[model samples]
Target: MGEEVHGPLAQTPTPSAGMQKIVTKHSFFCLKGKWKRGRHVVVVRIRSDRMCPQKFVFTVGVVAFTIAITLGGQVLADRFELANGETIEGTLLNPNERPRRVWLVRSSDGTSLQFDADAVTHVTRETPVQKEFHKIVSEYPDTIEGQWKLAEWCQEKKLEKERHDILEHMLELDPDHVEARRLLGYSRIDGKWHKREQLMAERGYSRYRGTWKTAQEIELSDRAEQTEVAQKNWIVRLKKLRMLVDKPQSSDSAAKEIREISDRHAVGALMLGISKEPAFRVRSWYLESLSRIATQEAFSAIVQIAIDHPDPETRLSATERLIVLGPHQAASYAVASLASEDSARINRAAEVLGRLGVSSAVDSLVNVLITVHTAVVSDGNSEGSTNATFTPSGGGLSMGGGAKRIKVESKNEAVLAALVKLTSVNFEWNPTAWRSWMATRQSPADCDFRRD
Candidate 1:
């Protein structure tokens, strides 16, 4: 078919030995050849059969051509070894000299640099993409549209730096090129295009990590990070201090240091020691230190200790400390604990709330005044039928049956006491009268003295 006519229509300088040429009408052309630096050059030209080539111009269609030079032995980036044990990586410009007395490189900043042969120990010039990039740019057009075409080709090859350079070059040709400006991170704001940094500056934003953030946000984040670092440092210090505090010889000094602690960040580390210390005297010291600090975190840890501590005296001590901080705070926390399924916790929380004397917890205390719990009770009964037998020779046997049991209800006394103490009225165990009194106080704006 048309495959015969797809061969090279014409080529200049006739491809020398070791050169390969392939052409396909409306398809693509692949040409391979070796350069002087032992690098193989591959030029992929996408062509449209309808376009006619004028002179030696290689631009063919919308998707014109691409050049990809590959290393001969799998080498990638350029490496230059200096005599002083330093290495330099860049695009080497003159790699095909006969004597190679001089080496030249185009630096990342687009500056031309030269090096004498004696100063360099060795050179590994591989960077095939950079080589092809320079070659294509040398022959490519200088116009914005022309450079944009090269930019598209670089994007296809994933040559980011080269694509960025071509985009910058497009900006130089025409500053208002919309696509180029957009690709280069420029936005049209208020009729003028501003770069990303400039736009961020105008909006009072700073780059944090990779995202834009306000100054206040950055400050808060910095403060939180510093607090975390301080907390970790306190953790390590407290471990050593805890060991010292256990020893009689250094206990006084360690206790003094912990007592003098003013940093709120140490609250978390102090809570760790307080929760794990078995000695009541040492735990008291930890609690005293937390109370001295009095941060929200410290208060919360104290609240948790008041509810979950195994020692009743210690729990009462924590509850007293919370009361010292503020009665309302302790009352709020204790009221929440009233909902616990454990009867003991309900009593303890009621005790805490009653000691705080906050009327706000009256409703909660009334609710848990008599919590009913389910229990499986067993009866002293036999599994099946009871039997009795009397044998000869004075041998006798008899069986006794057991009784069956059922579930029972219980009451919490502490909750009732808390409600009576809070309201100054003894509803005793009657929750309905307590709730009715509470409702009357809110609606009628007067106390209800009637009791059931």
Candidate 2:
């Protein structure tokens, strides 16, 4: 009995005096026990095939279940319908729906709300939304909502043609439409719009078919009759406007009315009136009106305005008009203005130099270019200076000089470019002399110098 053999039985260590004992059964039918104190315990258990596999399987099941739930929620959210002007936090249930017609969905207190599609005038996409909007407006021109939206969109987007067309169409639909009328009137006076009108007139639509019939009829009459009536009416209006300019009485409303008629009806008639009465105020107004009209006949009056007006701004404006008009008369006035000491005049002279193509003024242009270059170099280091440095080279003048030597700036290059263009008109006029001049000027050392 003293040496009786025992199976491999496990023994537990003795508990401390303050510890409590606990016992449990194992699956293998072996006894298991633990020592516990308060809520803490120490236990030992027999390893069994059943217990080891069950714990591993339970953990894998829970992880798979959580993943399935997450994926299913995403799929459901993406399939639901969304309203316009609504926003959703979840993924769209159907991404294939047309974005243009679709609206956003809003979730409030866990419920979704739908908004009317018409509430939104525009649909934004990742591409050129403006171009698409214009196309749609063009396709649906008769829809007032669409046209109005398109007009506003054109204005905001700076689509000049679209804005013009939309407003024109609106006026066509309702001639008395105040907003459309105002925009068209304003457009008629704009430089770009006037240019378009001129282009249209050249293409044989000076006046719209139904509109301005009386003016068109008058324009198509015999040239002599037209001229005589225009001249007579012009004289009458001229006398009235002159009285208004001279007296400036508060009661002279007729003069204002005549001016309005001139601006709206016949700018030429008003100009003829101004030519007879050369009051400074009247001349200024007349010149401004001609600039707005921008016709070839206005060139003569514009030149007179540049030369005879006392106001510097009026003179400068006339010079600008010459640049735009570019008639032979404008060229003559610009040539005279080249001799002016005023910087504004000189600048205007520089502007018209290329346009005028007056090769005889080459010496004057060269002097101007040299003076501008010198002023620029001298002002390079000045503080608190408002003057800008001038450079003939920036205006396409070619240069050549040795290091340490000041370069002589010349307008020969610009003058030559202009001559080349002008001589094309009649190359046989002075072919021999022109060719010789071109060859001599091409050589850097052979440029002629003459003191004015």
Candidate 3:
């Protein structure tokens, strides 16, 4: 009902004169005389003390009931099982007769079929809903309006799959069926009905992991995943190469392979090797390989090592490589590290920024001149103490109280040094005065013009 349609639901067509006669007869006979008894109907009359006319009326009623049951069986349908595992669903003629030599049935397509009684394995009675659906289908026309009526009945009967099938049939009769196509998840694209999946396929999209993605997006994602896997492999390979290079038998060949490494993916692996390799000579090899690669990633990694690596010699070696690569690029990374929560890292980054001699580092350096850090000093004993009574008191008393936390304000000497070196003017950890001085000293374009 929510689907947009070019027009309202179609009205059922008026029946022709001949069709009306047939419908009238069908309605009168089927509604009045059809007696359902587990796929069979039997007419039985009990004699009673009644008039001759009553007996005559009862005999006529029996014949009419029998005739209606015989005609209804043509559409009601029964499933027959054969000895060779074949199944047939149709109406069986003379189904009540047990010892008949041949079985006569009408198939779904109105074809009369006969099977040997000996070859029939079993007969399964149709369910009530199946029988009713078949009977309605036989009575209805094959038009879209007629099929829609059947679909609505199926919906009311809670036959979801049957309803879908009927809707599909309606589409076959009229492809532009607005309600049916919309109910079946179809949209009109370029004057034609298309399901969501079909439209996406036409636009070069594919279903991936339960979502639709374009071909370019899927290719990029796949390539990124592959690159990640390759980088992890390189990490493993570099570790093996480090080991092999230490051996006298394989040192030359392993060194050659390490030197030939050019893939940017190997940069992560090389950075890891440089930080973790304990031997100074092996670390030098990693650094040499990184310098030769000399990508922005490698430059940033070496800068990280310079600021964060635990070994002072390795840090100095990496810093030398940074100078050779370019110190201007290293300045931005150092400035970013100044915001680290670790006090040591802050100091290290400030130290590196100062050595780079970039005046842009002065703005960030002013902020970290003094930082206050909270430390929790937890004591198992509470933060209260008691002393024992002296002189004649026989009982001794001792008490302690809860833990305490302290805030320590640290003045970063490296940040102050960097700030003083960059500006040649000392604020002595007063950020406000430093800001004011820089504000007045700024160029015309750099001025922070404001009004309170």
Candidate 4:
């Protein structure tokens, strides 16, 4: 009769007039009827003339006590299904709050009946509608029409997988089922099936078809996606990457193709080719592709190209592309390259920063000179004689296909050239001069303020 709505819970709507009438009638007759019915009520009709008065009184008291206990547990209404498949709807009376081995149900006809819970197969709490659905589905579990009904119910309930499963079973039973395909979208035609959009597109149907395509169309769309997924296999992409490495033209064409690929597998294939291709030109091509890819991984592969590859032209090409990719945005990579002991990678990084006009390289260039000066520099070294100890910290400089331990500076070259190009100032052979110039320079670090 009374209900309270909590904040989290929705307000329970009041029952309709028709529902209230039915419930009010059902609750009263279904509970109080047993007392009015002389048949199943007290069972005290057998008047014993032979029995003692005290004994009769005790027997009547016991009967009343039993009835009181049964009535105490009754609810407004419930329905019980017996083992024999017979159902009884009435006010419920169970000794325990939950249904168990024994139940006392009082019917609307004023008859009370005790039922064994074991004999009752079901005790519905929410509604009998759930039981009805279960009974129908259990009775015809594998039937096409039965499953169709279930599928419809599932769809209405927004039970996606359950609805799809039911539809699949229906298709198994009848493969040519157009309704199933229509709901799912996509249908087979002459063996080679067409997509929903293609099918709907290739033929003009009534405006009655409306904007919503059938399930058959959706299935065709799914099929196309699956085909695309298949085409994106890593092995297939790897082969394509390999073929495209030299195709149309080198660097430019390969770079264009690599830029276009969005698939993860294709990216992996391109990276793999960059690192593993045995031929210099092939690896070079892959290197160009990675640069255009313009990802962290692509940047790393390009750095590796500069590190491990001996080809100057390829390294220059990769470095040129790298500078155009925002030198400041790629500052960390340049720093990492400079930190390396590889001569080729160092030179490439210097070149890249210089091309980008990154004046900040001056300090780095000065630091490199100061660090290696003791090891690589010689006294009065105008004659170009030099000696550098090959240590783990400072790798032997590469020259003429050999790891050269030393090279004399004629005023300054290579790395210094890059520093001078960037800062527009040359310290020549004086690392201290470069440092002093850097500290005193009034212009911004990127400014080309040198009086070259």
Model 3, stretches more than 4 Å misplaced?
1-193, 379-405, 419-452
- Candidate lDDT scores, in order, read 0.65, 0.44, 0.67, 0.52
In candidate 3, position 263 carries an lDDT of 82
Candidate 4 structure quality by residue, lDDT tens digits, 1-452: 22332221112243232221111111111112121111122221122224453221111111221222122223224655556544444456564756376666653333345555576677655254433432344334456777677778867766565466567667778776777767776668787545577775666522223565556676676777875575467556566656666566664665555555654334566655655666766655565556656777667656555444566676666666667766665555665666654444565666666666666566676655433321454456245656554332644444442323453222224667787776676667788787777778766766665565
Better of 2 and 4 by lDDT: 4
Clash-forming residue pairs, model 1: 379-403, 380-402, 380-403, 381-402, 381-403, 382-402
Model 3 over residues 1-452: C-alpha lDDT tens digits? 12221211122132222121111112212222122221222232223224452321111012223322223334536766665544445577767786678776654433344567876688767778967775666465677777788788989988676677777767778888899999888998788778988888998999997889998999999999999999999999998998898799999999888977888889999988876788887787788888888888888888998899999788878888887788778888888998787778888888887777777777788888887765444465644453222211122233234444455577899899887776677879799998898788764422222222
* Cα deviation of 94, candidate 3, in Å: 46
Alpha-carbon deviation at 395 in model 4, angstroms: 12
Question: Over the stretch 1-452, how does candidate 1's per-residue lDDT look in tens digits?
Answer: 11222322343233232333333332111112111111122232223223443212121111222222221212124656666554544457787887878776553433334567776687766556765664465445667677778889889978886687778767777899999999999999888988998879889998999989999999999999999999999999988988898799999999888777878888888888777878888778778888988878888888888888888888888888988898787777788888786778888888887777777777777777776654332343545543322111222222223433233344788888777776778878787988887877773322322243
Best by lDDT: 3
Model 2 per-residue lDDT at 157: 77
Model 2 ranges off by over 4 Å? 1-221, 244-279, 307-314, 324-329, 332-452
Better of 1 and 4 by TM-score: 1
Candidate 4 residues lying further than 4 Å off, grouped into runs, are: 1-236, 240-259, 278-288, 306-308, 342-345, 373-389, 392-413, 450-452
Clashes (N, CA, C under 3 Å) per candidate: 6, 9, 5, 11
Q: Alpha-carbon error at 77 in model 1, in Å?
A: 6.2
* TM of each candidate vs. truth: 0.57, 0.25, 0.51, 0.37
Worst 10 residues of 3 by lDDT: 16-25
